[model samples]
Target: MAEASYPEDLLYHPEHDWTKIADGVATFGITWYAQDALGEVVFFDPPEVGSSVTAGQSYAEVESVKAVSDVFAPLSGEIVEVNTALGDTPEAINDDPYGAGWMVKVSLSEESEQESLLDRAAYVASLT
Candidate 1:
């Protein structure tokens, strides 16, 4: 896989969640690849603030014209904030998968878990 494939700075989950840590909190969202696969997102159901989420488990869901996809937690943690903007305009996800389309912030319970996820190179390779 080329360096230009997936965002190298983030961690990727097999289910398509990507997490970027900043100021000790991990911000998460679906990858561009995921949004493309889901197709024309129409709705997003984010977990409530302060909800506890386990690693490798669904914390939210996205409904698209094609199907519904679970948004998994990249790691075990408590959700601190959600991108409320997505609820009003879910298509933002397909238009900007890595920016304003971000889903939530999780106060990471175990920082070491970040090391276990796939990197950009590995994630792209996994696609094949």
Candidate 2:
């Protein structure tokens, strides 16, 4: 399982999604907290590329041994890439949530939506 960590360079949404932005694209994944809560992941049905996703919306779903949960979009964007590897190795979400588990990368559609996201400190604080 992934050790609990909230990377400093990333932003967080209250729904337990994390964001890593580079150029105009942003990568998204569930936080360590979200995966831990879900237990061992067994399936991940990712959205198709070229789809538009809005911030605070559910774009996909992850099924763990314990439950199925929606994967929320942390920013508004048009999807550019998806980690297809997760289809065969969904456990990567629990094993390396921030790395191998990244779900989607999107070309951001609304830059201003980022301001609503929390930083590492604020996100961790929200957990309390």
| Best candidate according to lDDT | 2
lDDT of 1 at 5: 37
Local accuracy of candidate 1 as per-residue lDDT tens digits, 4-111: 236779889988889999887999999978887888899999899999999899999999987898988889889999999999988888888888889999998898
Q: TM-score for candidate 1, please give it.
A: 0.93
User: How far is 30's C-alpha from truth in model 2 (Å)?
Assistant: 0.3
lDDT against the true structure, per candidate, is 0.87, 0.95
Predicted candidate 2 versus true structure: per-residue lDDT over 2-121, tens digit per residue: 469988999999999999999999999999999999999999999999999999999999998778899999999999999999999999999999999999999999988999999999
Model 2 residue runs over 4 Å out of place are none
For model 2, where is the 10-residue window of minimal lDDT?
1-10
Off by over 4 Å in 1: 1-5
Question: Which 10-residue window in model 1 sums to the lowest lDDT?
Answer: 1-10
Error of 1 at 47 (Å): 0.8
Among these predicted structures, which one has the highest TM-score? Answer: 2
